[model samples]
Target: MNKKDSIKACGRTINYEIVYSKKRNKASIVISPDLKVEFRAPHGISSETIRKMVSEKAEWIQKKLEWFEVNRLPDHKKQYCEGEIYLYLGREYPLKIIAFDDVKEPIVSVKDSELNFVVPKKDSEDTLPLLIKKAVWNFYSKRAEEEVEKVLKVYSKKLGIAPPTFKVKHQKRRWGSCSADNVLRINFQLVMAPPEQLEYVVVHELCHVIEKNHSARFWKLVKQMMPDYEEYRKSLKKEGWKYML
Candidate 1:
């Protein structure tokens, strides 16, 4: 079951959703990327108990909400049209939409400091945005494939370990993760970030193969690989949302 509720925190009433699940053994609270708060609790948990738990976690929840507020992507209702700026490798480039009569599918390319979108003339203005979004995704996915592979190869060789298979996809809450089988999954949105930031994420996840947790030893390995990793990591938190299309 799902229900909407609100809790008082920091002299304000913060709205949230409650989900009751049989699979859950305890209560868990999460602040979504969009700043929506959610609480999942096991069956038979009382509302008062849940409210008390939320009160206990009120400070932490407020901190997360503030972080999201500061880091959220500006212009969430951005229309994919000409003159709109997009990020590539930490640089902003204006988008140029070019309608072509003979083009069968949307094609996106970067040339001379501009992102060009070649779309069929038959597509309506409403449909053009969707097509442009698809084109942009394709462009990022291709770059992710090339750039992530190169970084992984270099780091794997330096670390003297077999490189794990990696793939890029959309992720809501994580930059990258290492699976139990040692496979690496990178967020393709990161392709828009600077190369150094991308490399930092790669090395951080690669260190997970040696140490599964973010303990001192795991961070030690990460520092050994990239001495400036902490700076890059903080930058990811501060300005990473600019890359989200």
Candidate 2:
């Protein structure tokens, strides 16, 4: 079953809906079209706590019915365009779309620190968007892999831990994940985020090799490596999600 169907409420496996507002940065629980329960503070709150908090405020749920109505743009469907700015390694670069006939595959080029998208003529404009996106993603994915290798070399040497096998994936809900088998999965879309964000994601997952959960000890290790991680986390919410199409 889906998450919505799996969650239970008030001793009943009732359908629970989550309502969020970017302006408020808060989440509210609503029961179908009937009721809404607002959580005043949801930052860093886990799902179970959210559910329990909602249950405690079940009485005001009906009163906040209007908040249940919300509309949001579909994730990462925004089209890439020339002059549109993107972040790479904490720096902003303007997108320059170049139409050329000599190149067979879409290529992303950086010269004097300016980024450009070079595409062949055979690819139709209708398909150009996807091509450009793919080209960019591939470029960044390779870069992320390379960066991971370099960072792992440095950290492993310092920590006296060897680099372990890791997989690269494009996760919609998370930047990275680690399995019980010690296999690390890094998100490919992370290449679109700033440099510090990308580094945090990699290190965060690597730390998971030692501590599987986000307990205080895990964060302590992360902070030892990256003291500015909280800023990076907040930065991801601001613009990092745009990486995936």
Candidate 3:
């Protein structure tokens, strides 16, 4: 028989498999689709030991699923209308659609912290919304570059590593990441967050220069730079809806 077999644990039948890896120093239990549990063990670890570990940690695995369900991103089906409030950086602003003449294309302008989008007076609200999205993309792309540079310079000196090139993207699940090749990619959605949170993410990615993985030491480095990062990290979870339009 294959290593994978059905076993009952915690009043539930867990379909699982065992695999060995040379790079793994510890046994890890991964729950796969159809609720199949996989035990990834270090080379030479016994199957019996792996099974015992899985049985013992069944509660923890269930907790992980509970947490995932609780924190899953909400469906983004919010309806947008005229004069709705939106935020960029730390400031709040009302969405204003400025009407134009002569069939001019829509444009966005910022004056004294207020954002205004130019659309023909006769244009449809649908057109205005599309223009606003395009303008937001352009505006945040430039701002993201500037803000990233500001935070990178501070952490690069503290970590004693050269700053790497950065790219701005609209990432789905991550706020930022640093690759092994030293490229730093930041999510443009951060433009919707407050300035302090954005800076925290920057420092978080910059700390990856010293440690690639999310090890304890990596978080220690982040704490050294931003002492209250734990609070900010929780804030990201609590106020996640505010960051979306």
Candidate 4:
């Protein structure tokens, strides 16, 4: 049988699918030229033990992924122009931009496999592009507010803690964070990832309500809420370049 699992390695989450064989004696990690990670192992090994072993070797795995990243251009890079492919909920959607001065806010919606974007105004030649890009981003942040809140509510109950005040916003390098004052801040770009990936971030932040740091207890609490969360985290990291505007 094949199983999906994740390990925190080199301060990054590495998700891999594992194949079990009764005859195999040693577990090995295989990295495809395209950077997909797979593990082959003997049967009857506990997941925690496997995770520990993988974590020990995570530095190597992380370096391999980085090597591939450095050697190749990012996959699905976006230009924020018409005909560009965009992602939402892990699905691809082509971008379609329209400008209107009548509206006060940028409007973005998905319909018929298109990311329909409406800008607040049609500006002068040079400024229009920047305006549209900013507007499109704002649309993402707004939608994140709606979508992320629903997930936070669901996981909040599962964790048996009152959902704290949270906001969807931009972070230059971080995905999500929980403040010392008990507020949760999620990345707006996360809405473009798959639902499970988004759920993982929400659960990760919500768990902070109980465990303030990424200590052993914090990870244990996270694992309790989502056993496959590391897989999602790894996935998000892998395809993250394609998901942003």
Give the candidate number with the greatest TM-score: 1
TM-score of 3: 0.67
Error of 2 at 58 (Å): 5.3
1-245 in candidate 3: lDDT tens per residue? 23775557666665678867554578778753224467877788777777677778878767665566666555553243456666788677776666768757666656665677777778777666666787767777778888889888888888888877899887854688888777889987787788788888888888877788778998999999999998888887666556654
Give all candidates' CA lDDT scores.
0.88, 0.67, 0.74, 0.81
Q: Which runs of model 3 end up more than 4 angstroms from their true locations?
A: 1-80, 102-105, 121-124
Better of 2 and 4 by TM-score: 2
| TM-scores, all models, native as reference | 0.80, 0.68, 0.67, 0.66
Overlapping backbone residue pairs in candidate 4 total 0
User: Ten consecutive residues with minimal summed lDDT in candidate 2?
Assistant: 1-10
Regions of candidate 4 where Cα sits further than 4 Å from its true position = 1-70, 74-77, 99-106, 119-125
Candidate 1: segments with Cα more than 4 A from true spot: 1-12, 16-34, 38-53, 57-73
**Candidate 2: residue 243 Cα off by (Å):** 4.5
- Arranged by TM-score with the best first, the candidates are 1, 2, 3, 4
* Lowest lDDT block of 10, candidate 1: 71-80
lDDT of 4 by residue, 93-128 (tens): 888877787977667788988998777664555765
